[model samples]
Target chain A: MNLPDRHISLAHGNGGRLMRELIELLFAKHLKNPTLDVQADAVTLPLERHGELLFTTDGFTVQPLEFPGGNIGSLSVHGTTNDLAVSGAIPKYLSLNAFIEEGFEVAALERIIISIAQAAKAIDVAVVAGDTKVVRRGEGGGVYLATTGIGIKTTEINLSMSQIQPGDRLLVSGPVGDHGIAVMLAREQFGLRGDLMSDAASVLPFTQALLDLPGLRFMRDPTRGGLATVAHELCRGTGLRVNLDQSAIPLRDPVVSVCDMLGYDPLYLACEGRVVAVIAADQADQALQRWQALPGGELARIIGETESNDPFVVLHTELGGSRILDELEDDPLPRIC
Target chain B: MNLPDRHISLAHGNGGRLMRELIELLFAKHLKNPTLDVQADAVTLPLERHGELLFTTDGFTVQPLEFPGGNIGSLSVHGTTNDLAVSGAIPKYLSLNAFIEEGFEVAALERIIISIAQAAKAIDVAVVAGDTKVVRRGEGGGVYLATTGIGIKTTEINLSMSQIQPGDRLLVSGPVGDHGIAVMLAREQFGLRGDLMSDAASVLPFTQALLDLPGLRFMRDPTRGGLATVAHELCRGTGLRVNLDQSAIPLRDPVVSVCDMLGYDPLYLACEGRVVAVIAADQADQALQRWQALPGGELARIIGETESNDPFVVLHTELGGSRILDELEDDPLPRIC
Candidate 1:
């Protein structure tokens, strides 16, 4: 069946002929897989052996539809899968939900769908089930995606914030705030432009390398509220003081320049493809070496450490001055992920 | 932390203090379960045994957010779980994604969250994971929800549209079009009002009773595009003619009256909580008896049958005349689901 319209219409979501054609010619064609059956309401997934299952979900509404390094499609896939990866699980299957606006360009939708398929294939995960809905033109952003991921835990590594203890060290996989600055530049809302690309890729390699380390207490991808927000969560979760050496943290020049010019703090910006890991001080160097050797982890750093029980985050500046980093209050960026 | 504002702000989704408070005071407070941890990046789900896993997803963007019988929250739960139910699986876990518009009322959001928790509790399904995003006011319909369900196929009954034979009988668990008419009435679009309620309940009881039946060929919940759409799918899928006896198909009085007044067809309307099943001709009576004994299935009937290899749907009217029911074209109601 051919989709005769160049732009989506309300009829495309009415669950009728148009909807079927949209699914057949666009979504189904691009995301074709053995597990995806348009005729079946539910798809069956084969589990070789189920010991433990990891489930996570995330919603994406990044503006511009297309960003420098990734669009909402690829970002949605990575956002959900990264959550599972950081939790020490082998990402397996994902279900997608797309809420599109009427009058959206069909060609752009196809591109986004193709990106989704590619990103899922990159991680060897299947887009097993999906749904699409079109809202009235003004009632939705150009496109919004939500993905729910199912992963299997193949190892005995159990990571959680509750496992963090005083004297633990914190390491970041790579530079921070690239995704936030890149997306901001794509928006062009501030009369600024740059060639910076979003750091929006699956963090599976970083997490997998450290899954075998017994000292790895927890791992989380610094996303919406960025590195400082993650530190706040750790302090609140473990009631321990988090001390960060600001000079040790990695940051790209473009991101730092953007932040400096816009009065934005890079530490509170989002990063899609970075990991903040809490590890025992004894194994911190080993963890840092492993990440630094990976493709995207050349700038990986042992950025901080946990101190006595005070439940606060402290940033030690390069000039030998220390200041408490308050929990994020106002939103500097919205719809970032 | 107390929410001082009555309406949602962009910061509530920015992964900051307000977002954390919103989750803790609203979502976490209402949908508290042992498996749900707001601080965790991903949650671990325990599987007692290995078996076939059923996965399905659905997006909900019903207008008026709150309708007659139920709101979008409960409807989302029923919508995704019903897909699993009709597939002959026992729904085990669900992951929810909410996209909220800025300036939406906090109290109303709480109400919807409470409803979601209630609906999940009613079915013994755990909401294991969730994510929330807030968009600018004009970029979203107050609240759009997407739910992905995971189920375990405990029964040996394998049902599919391909299993439907030419002589199979079609049974409807109850009346059609109540949800569509009820929502339309709630909208008061045409200066009309009615006390009719939506038939938006889970079809688990109906599907469960017939799962063991040897003659149960296929089962589907008539949702958006309603029973006629399901009939159309049956014909197109199996290359068989669908003959519906309009006189035997059950519909409520208010729904019929609304359709008659509005030039609408009940068969094309949506039904949130009803089942359309295909059974062997010889076992049609047995299936009807089983459904009729259930509380909500009192109006069950053998409404149609499959015949020949023409791939079309024909409605046999009460006056002994028949007309072809064409595939749905324009959307009568855009956000009914």
Candidate 2:
């Protein structure tokens, strides 16, 4: 059976004939698996006897949903998976809940579904359970997606902010602000264009590599408020001072140019796929060398280190002056995912 | 620290200082537990040695956000918990994600959070992880919540539509249409008022009681499209005919009057807290008696029986006539759940 060749109606969320058809034809067709095919209220997951489970949830509401590098569909998967990855867990399954506007196009929905399926497949994760709801046309954006990810921690690694100590070196996986810049240019409100794409991809490989390193203290993805915000949180949580060498932080040319033109700091812009980690100061050099050898970590750098007992982020600029990096106060961007 | 005393701005979702304050002062303050207090990328849950895990997710966008008996906050918990309950699993943890409109009131949000915590506590579940996003004022309803629940099956029961047989009897927990009617009246569009309260609560106790019964084949909460739609799904899945006795169905007087006035079929309206189970015909009476003796199942009824190979629902009306129960074709009521 074919779906209505038009926009989605409230009937599509009625949980009856049309809803079942939409699920079977669209969702199931793209994300087919034994667990999902059961169509039960809940999917039964078979787990090995003893490891701990990782749980994460995120809501994606990126405007102009389809962007240069990825769309909201791919962003949702990457966002949740990255959370699990940074926490030393192997992402396994996800539950997707979609809030669609009543008149959203079926074609657009199908494209997003296909993208989600591909993303999940690439990361070896299963879409085990899902739910959909429709709101009146103006009551919702085109679509908003919330995802819950479940992962398994197989290794005996312990990562926590409390482990961050004085002299611990900080390293970032790649360049900062690519995702924020890409999405901003796609909006076209600034009359700027760029070929830059978001660094949005699974960081499982990079995180896994660091798991074997005994010097690793903690790791986090620099997402919503970017690297500076992450540094601020690490300082706040551990009651330590983070001194960052701003010149050492890597940035793409376009990102640098846009930040200069728009009076934005690259450190405050969001990154869809990047990680910030603390490694024992003595092993910092080895960690950087190893990371640089990896594809996604080619631009990795040792940008900063922790200092004793001061709960603030201090930026050491190239001009021989230092400034305290304060927390964000204004809502500079909306729906940046 | 205190949350900003104003409408939620985009800064609240910026993953910076304001965002942390909002979460710590509001959500975490109310739903706080050891696991959630960790504030890690993901909470690592320790499960017992061996058992199949159950995963379910649902999005709640009920209009007016609050109604007589419960609000969207409590409804969100009940909705996801009930899904797990019907699967014969013990509800454990939930991941909550909320999308709030830019100008939504802080007080209303606090009220909602308090309700959620109470609901979760009553059901012996933990709010282990959560995420929040704020959309532009008009891009969302006041607030929409999506919850993912993880449960464990401790019993050896395996329930599926495939287990439904020709002689299986259908039993409903209690009266229908209370939730849908209550929400409709709360909207005041119909110019009707009543003391009607939604039957939105956890069905854990009810489902837990039936887990020990061997005659129980399958169970589902007749939510979104109601009992009639559920019957249709069972018939379509198993290629069986369901002959339902309309006279045996239970209804509250206010619900019946409202349905009559609006020309709405009570059979097609939603029930937030109810169950429809398929039991062996010979054991149906015992199941009914046991359910009727419970707190919320005072009006439990054996409403129908399954017949082989017909693949449709036949309604034997109180007027002594039979008619085909067609699948839901349109949106009878939106946001009922």
Candidate 3:
């Protein structure tokens, strides 16, 4: 912890004394575990012989490194792990890559690293390996994190878009657009401010609770393109029409108000900690009940269903009409994740 | 292949139609393999149950993205895989993360992706998972890459600094400082030019060749901080004095000239493709012969040896005088790897 500089410099990434000190004092100190060896080129992982291995990766470049409920550090961990979670796996190990800009505050870096450690510890996942690189000033965002997660799939059920049928129902674990709006408001670009926190927590519990159900077809965390994008994916993958009821979907008051004020579609906004699951029509109610029993799934609802052979995402209106939800083109928010 | 824009935009990382097209046409097309599933949130990997699993990660931020012998794309693959290689493991899978700046050339991106594919294919490794993010122009280097490699340790031999003893001999696979000087000259900051290509390549062949040698105590690729820094690491780790013979160390003419002109120490320069190994004195000549028989190991030499209990890296000058080689402080070359 004998860091001599308050701000990072190019030497910190030079693989020299400074780089070693930064990694040892900051990164390794925060993410210390039995599996992590700063001196070794690689660490060995212990795995069971029977289960299928799962691998997933994600990159986080959210603006305003610190957001309402989570920062890029915590979000990076949740994001990659959730990918494995929705795929019916238990995340066990993560490898982190940090791209830090020269001149960034060392204290801020420590805070983010601490956040990453806390989030990873919460889920019992260890950051077994990591690398740090420093980009020259103006050549990087304050910090960008990329995490690759390794997991083990113990479930007998195979969940995939190919498993979806025409009559399969769609259920959401919670409200959508909370993460997107929370980040936007944090930016204060439109002079908007709110106490809304991002719902950027792990979706492991929600995905695990329904794994025992034979009716579960597929599950995906609605991330960058949100609920409607997941709907579009289902349509494209299954070659079916997606019918979403606007009145049935759950939306928070603040998220709805912000979307209304900014002329953005809540359905297409990103949600970090939500799950849109495809379930057999007969078991949709049971899935909803199970999700609702979870802490973050109070607003769990059956919002949509797949039908017909056409590949279109249709949102049913309250006025007894429906409109097509086009695929995302222009980015409404850049670096949202 | 039907990309409309000549340059990348923010939408390409927004997890939308554009992102899908870019991934499908560029990344997924080139990196296609049986284990890679672009549509799946997480891909399943087939791993043997008996072998120890090795995990390693590295981040690449080399400026002028492309150099004489390689680009950041190829370097990223080699860098991460090399870590596993020196750890006495056979690299199997890799997960790539790219942080690209908006307004970058699409064609250049394609070339880099192709290089990545080619390099991975050369080593018979697969890029099973990946993620991409776009930073606003001026907020990032052209592109930064992070790769996490997963390999299985089939060899029962354990290589570590803890296994080192007095009288251990040191051998380098090839000439040093080529990669550092090559990248530096590529920048044209020193107004120097050369036909020297980077030594950036996988050290799998070198390390694999010596894994069967029971006399081999430890091996490391002389990367960012080069051979001298590695020697310092040996001294610090084992509390042993390292005696390096300057004349015996291999150094290419162009690298030596560049270092003399730039007033930089060749010992501290990076070598992306070289290996500095510690072997028992009784078997040092055997290890050297094995390395010299390889394609890029013509200059392989026994450069140094460990002796006594004092923790100092001493350079034995050709004049019979010795000087202590200090641990690297200032970074002469940043992002050489």
Candidate with top DockQ is 1
Q: Which ranges in model 3 have alpha carbons more than 4 Å from their true place?
A: A1-5, B1-5
What is the C-alpha lDDT profile of model 1 across B203-299, one tens digit per residue? 9989999988898999999998999999999999899999999999999999899899889999999999999999999999999999999998899
The residue ranges of model 1 lying beyond 4 angstroms of the native Cα positions read A1-5, B1-5
* Model 2 agreement with the true structure over B45-98: per-residue lDDT tens digits: 766656678999999999989999999999999999999999999999999999
- The estimated TM-scores of all candidates read 0.99, 0.98, 0.99
CAPRI class assigned to model 2: high
Docking class of 1: high
Better of 1 and 3 by lDDT: 1
Model 3 lDDT per residue over B1-337, tens place: 4453578899999889999988999999999999998888999988777788999999999988999999999999999999999999999999989998999888898889999999999999999999989899999888899999999997486999999999999999999999999999999988999999999999999999999999899999889889999998899889999999999999999999988888999999998888889999999999999999999899999998999867999999999999998889899988686
lDDT of 2 at B318: 89
Interface RMSD of 3: 0.8
Q: Which 10 consecutive residues of model 3 chain B have the lowest summed lDDT? A: B1-10
Clashing pairs in 1: none
lDDT of 1 by residue, A287-336 (tens): 99999999999999999999986788999999999999998998888878
> In model 3, how large is the Cα lDDT of residue B80?
93
Native interface contact recovery, model 3: 0.93
User: What C-alpha lDDT, on a 0 to 100 scale, does residue B261 get in candidate 2?
Assistant: 93
Each prediction's RMSD over C-alphas, in Å, is 1.2, 1.3, 1.2
